[model samples]
Target: MVSSGGAAGTSATAAGAAAAAAHSYKQLKEEFVSNLSGGSVTEIAQVCAVAPVVSLLWSVLQARQSFFEPYTPLAFIVDFLLNVGALLLSVTLYSNAPLLLNLLLLTVATFIYLIPADPSIRRKKAKLPPNASSKPSPAGSSPPLGVLSTKPFLTNYRGNMLVVTCICILAVDFRLFPRRFAKVETWGTSLMDMGVGSFVYSAGIVASRPLLKEKAEGKTSPLSTRLVRSFRHSIPLLVLGVVRLLSVKGLDYAEHVTEYGVHWNFFFTLGFLPPFVALFQSALKLVPSYAALAVLLSVGYQVLLEYTELKAFILVGARDNLVSMNREGIFSFLGYLAIFLAGQDAGMFVLPRALPSRFGLSKRYTMLANMAAWTLGWWGLYFLVTNYRVGFGLSVSRRLANLPYVLWVVAFNSGLLFAFALADVVLFPGFYGATDARVEKDMYETATSKVLKAYNRNGLAVFLLANLLTGLVNMTVPTLHVGAVTTVGILGLYMVTLTGVAVGLDVYNVTIKL
Candidate 1:
């Protein structure tokens, strides 16, 4: 399901002396990220396999809330280092052989999952809640282990994706980080391109439950009320955006302005998008299908690109007006909005039935299988066939966030969500698909799960720290000149810092909301 793109690097910018003086530091690093073609879907898909594969390994090895849980620091270190450590390597050193490594790991995990283990190895260890039984299951029988539910998987996914984005944001400044993994200039994808869309898509996934609930209840708020609530939720983001803009300008930071724009950043895009969705959703909710709504928006945007001047406007070096100055960020808004809607649609399908509902194993199995089917069906048949045979053969562009890009993000995220869902089914042996959150009495939590949930719970704080640290690193170190070995070491240390802080927060029961 790989997409075809224009050249390796393409963006619109003017390299004038005034602009050059205003952005003097780390010019090489700026060029390093500019106008690069990205990795293929096949390669990205291979990289994504590690998380699901590792989750299985955790299950087969009984790392789930086992005696290892007693050794808190050691368990967290072992679990996180193995999981994120492997991820770091794939996107850096072993990127060339991601498929082979992932396949080998998957094979080992599969064997361990299927073969019976020595009783000693399989013994259960997670401490149950006070009201729940702590006694071990009878010998020779599979414990009524954790019941598979969607919440834990969703939590882990959100955290993992956030961490991945954070990793790329910092790593891209270094030479060892693959250019193919960097954000594309005009049209194409790389891991970084996927990362940005994933952020927007994830927000949609969380937003959908509430958005749809409102629809189900036939509830509508006044435009002013909607704006107030949405802006309240988005203020931190807007403040962060303003701070970033000011900081970059004040420091004369070497920024690839074309990425967002001369005056825009991701924080602004994130802040602006949710409120736009809120104001417009009253009209959009009138249509029942989010997928349909996404298609309408994407196709309409594509029409503007083809028939109007929007595409040319974004691709040109026009700084004559405010709209032209922030063209990439502004023009791409509709595309992102479509991606958000698509994510919401996916949420509608995968979100388990309401709490305390009588969802059964059959339903869970069907739900997970449906995710797999959609991922496979769209990836193998719909995405590929349409990309190759459809109108004008549009390439996936994070800059444009056009039709092809929206579809790609939706398909890509569906695959990741499916992987997380599949992990629950395989790891939590006895009960599958039961929506009762409390059904996890016998289920053991893996360090990866706990750590990731911690990050998700304190996402805004983590993101701020990452941005601050990334800036510090780029300022103090000559990142563009770092050797591969040194680059890897630096990235490793960065990951350790992030993982440790997140784990500490989790350990201390810290929940910092934006």
Candidate 2:
């Protein structure tokens, strides 16, 4: 009996020790997460580990044909793995490397795989006589392989990218992942900022298209009428901003100066930049020239802000009384205007022209080359200004919308658009031909396409819905106390729910246009 009691006591002691160890492990995990840096090794490992699963899911759903149709299943699997591995290595270790090397490498690899030695090219070459002239054919003489579309400002690609950005922002806001995973301040420049800038710049370009096109064609309206129209157009944004601000403040949600709110950069850009740009275009008579002038003016404005220490005044609240006025909103409007003007310039170049029915390899190559040149030029300028203009205070300040910021926005947007155009050419080779209807029907009829179309159709509504849901979720849930895995699960559910609602509304032809 004494021996049996001793054995039982030993068993109980072992059980207590095991329970204590489990508790210690849980506490350690919590502490580790709380103290994680902006770019934690663990966070990087997690991203890398999950990337393949994410890629696999994306391939099955949205990237079905685009990814798998061009290559065999085995090849697709191998390439996906390699691409994800490269991306993980680049993002985690060499974050400062130029222009996301992983994406560049993947794009190049895909391009090469799709454009392998074509029998058609060999046959055409064989038919050519030995003494035939090697001069390139005229641009319009032959049917081309594919043509770049003129209306690229707010296309499905940009919309999808915006949706992804919105999701990331929501995830960060909910603390579903480590703060380092989506921390904006981690890098000198971040993909998150660039994504936001791209959306805003596209919005500016789209909003200004009609007015700029009309003015370019010498069909100018009266100044008073133009101003009134601009104001009328801005009414919706103004109302939305006010409503969002009130909701956020009333609900006592966390506030950030950069995201959408009463003082959001987007709100001020839509409300004030349009009339200003229209008036400037009226005076200049050339949209591109006005864009250049806007750049110069933006530089001057940045210098003025620096000289007067306006950023300090607003950020540090040198004067407490002026704090209520939200000088950040008032001053940052200039930078946003600069970005809008740059978009206007891009639109002037790409839009307002007859798009070719067919774009040949040579033509497409030339276009890509031109885009690359422009991207390089802007990026070089950004590098120079940011590196050398320290005394002048020029860096990628999203708040200030400085010269470097504008250049970065323009450079990255141009590069992404070019990449997307190239991808479209490869994915839908029949897109540029007279059989466009068939291609569109086949591609657009897919479930993935429908959902993307829904988001594209009601992007603003989706954004507003996300904001509202975010507030509700924060109110109801212990978001901060949740584990990372639980947080991710919640985020996924939220995004899927949002996507479903958007798709349903789209199917019913209900768009909340503003």
Candidate 3:
């Protein structure tokens, strides 16, 4: 009665898992050794396998000095490698070790990295006296414009840092976060899903801002008047009605709607971001930075372990609501907002310096760098995620947001942005060349410019559309499949549809370049 077939299948699965784990382990070791010192022969060989990519990024970084001014290709390479290494280590540590142990390790690593080695280390690296500049201002007490300018380099670097942070967040999600994050059916799932959709759409609005301007005044077209009334008025009602109908139909009869209702979508999240950003912008302007921080502190007060549990208990006490709404709605949501604001402020710093004439880097090289970073980021994410299959059980759920996962998510998000930026360059060549205040002039560069301009030239619309469609797909599709053939068939169909839409839109001049 001993079944040879059963034994073989088990052995195969185990072997596959072991092989995956070993590959990941090898990758981690090579990347770590390469980065810490000069890579060994084996490490170099592994890196060389991806050298075409690495060389491209290095060249691109050198060429795109305007966007990457004050940073060298070497810096990006180092950071990219570090990001990949961190993602791998985090996945390995989380999947194989106890949660508490890994968390402690992460805490230690972050603290050590963030904290200065010397307690009394001074940040000021300047050798010149504050007033030593030859061109003194009327207000002699004020620092010189160019010399004391934190506006260009500081803000630009921080913006780059934010990009890196976003990339890290992506890595975590793809690699480790999903394992620990609550399953799709977990508490607050519906609200969270909706919130995410709203946030994504709202964020898109921010991207769209550059595309929308008054013809006469050239000021950003104020949509707050229409959008505030429409979104605030409609979305809630829509959600409520949909939820109520599902409740009435009963679960057995309307299982799909009921389950989908629980999940939040990216479109909803992006839709809300712009108005929120606008509101926050005005609020921050009125208050001093310290005062703003104070407000943030107060709002963030309910985020502590005790307070969060108590608040959740009170809000969803008896209702079958997601329990972790407090965490999602408040803590993580605020973090996202902070990241967004940081990015916004950073744009101001980068835009001034990223003027076309100032962009001295060769375009081809810049594109190459972007491609390399994009590729490596994806590659790193791939390893981080697949490593889990081998026994390193990294989980990015609510209960266990491991540090490695955090880093991965941040990296992934940044990598996406960079890749998109590169795509934009290809589609809308010279799009960012215009420095004039006119949005029309700033929108296009090529003969196909009209088509690109017509399509959500703001870049936000594309993201919103994509997010909405993706979310809808996630909601409706039976994501689970038994075999490769079925999965491939479904994916192929989806891609075909997407391609058809793209081609149709292009023919109609509705397509954006990217």
Candidate 4:
């Protein structure tokens, strides 16, 4: 018979061992993500290029489906595997995927799929609407022109951004996810580095829809009204921030404190940026001048970082106070607002009505041309700002959310947009938005577009779900010890599960706003 004293001692020892193991596991993760330089701009760009390649592939297959006798399940499986599945692999197992080679191969595959003269595959080519070739319809006419209409390429852009961001957040835990693509300790670029910024940019594309409409109508909401609306809209994110903070702390989750700070998390950053942007716009009355606001904020923030001791304070300051403890989140608020505004600027120009009929180019070509120009211009500025002699002479730092970093986000995203638009021209020959209309009404909706539209419609909901599942996954699985094959399997299952939920929501016409 054991004595009560011995039993108490045994319990105490086991508790200590468990505590030590938990600490070690957390320490291991902190080290895994810490003090690392990021990958090359070229590599980052290459990795991002996969988004457009897969989006184009999906669009093509769906377009072809429009021509052929529909096999709904086969279409879904083939396109999902080829497009989303390939994108998943590109980031994980093939992180070092050769850019030029993949592009060439995919390009060849695109041509082969397109150029082949299969009698069965060919059908009556989809044409513009009967009235499409006529002068633009009057505003009040039947089937009126959708002045605020969005493009599929843009929808594809936002959906792809969400999917890519979600994939990286969880996949980075596994051995299969390349360390070079992980978020850097202080400075540089990576696939993971692009996640938050791209997601913010994606969200911003639609968030400014109301503001854009108001601007077009020459209507303005009072500052107080704007504040209330912005805050009300942001409640979900704010609540999510609180929930995440509580969960991470209460559950003793493995958190790299330096990523956000002692108390701050990304949800907080996302929650607060909009209201501040609203405040700025209300004070300055710069409605629809998003590019100007973005430039002003980024450049002003960079000045503080470069000229003042603010940079050191954020980078190496003591975390003794609330402000210091969450400086990264607090300080980066403006930079992210800048990125969001840049996206808003992109959003305004993306509408078909934003392009002039006198440009001598169709809507697709006009948007593509503008996107290419914007992308090239932003890249030019990125290089310029990065070179000390030519410009600001600062490297990209997501932690700091500096000027070059903002420029990089815009450049990469816009470049991706250009790629998507180009794909529309190649695979979808008619006006960018018209092809999608024809596809749905004339025949069946391809499962690929359905999936993308589902994601686009409920991005925040999907993001929340991804976060929850990521935490659940971490607790359930030994992510660190998992082999490449196991990691891939887990990721495939995880992604399919997410897509399924998203599709399920769409099927029921149930949208998760909060």
Best by lDDT: 4
**What does candidate 1's lDDT look like per residue over 1-514, in tens digits?**
3333422222213335546744554566677788788878888878767766666665555533243445567766766765677778778887788887788777876776566654543453233322234444555444433212335567767877877877888988887778888888887778888888888988888877765566557776687887888888889898999999999998867888888788989888888877888766776648767777887888889889889877888888678888789988888888888888878777877664432323353555677867887778546533652465653566777898888888888888888899877776555544333223334433435323666777787887898899999998987888876899999999989988988898789888878877
Per-candidate RMSD vs. true structure? Answer: 9.8, 10.8, 17.8, 3.2
**TM-score of model 2 relative to the true fold?**
0.67
For all predicted structures, in order, the TM-scores are 0.84, 0.67, 0.39, 0.91
Each model's lDDT comes to: 0.73, 0.54, 0.34, 0.77
Estimate candidate 3's alpha-carbon lDDT, on a 0 to 1 scale: 0.34
Q: What local lDDT does model 2 show for residue 19?
A: 78
User: Which pairs clash (backbone N, Cα, C closer than 3 Å) in model 2?
Assistant: 146-359
Q: Look at candidate 4 and tell me the lDDT of residue 201.
A: 81
Per-candidate clashes, comma-separated? 3, 1, 62, 0
- Candidate 1 vs 2: which has more lDDT: 1
Sorted on TM-score, best first, the list reads 4, 1, 2, 3
Error of model 1, residue 391, in angstroms: 5.5
lDDT of candidate 2 over 298-329, digit per residue (tens) = 78886786788775665555334433346666
Could you tell me the lDDT of residue 418 within candidate 4?
Answer: 82
State the lDDT of candidate 4 residue by residue for 334-441, as single tens digits. 788899988888887875355764369866577777888888988898889998887768889999889988988888888887887777566655443442334323
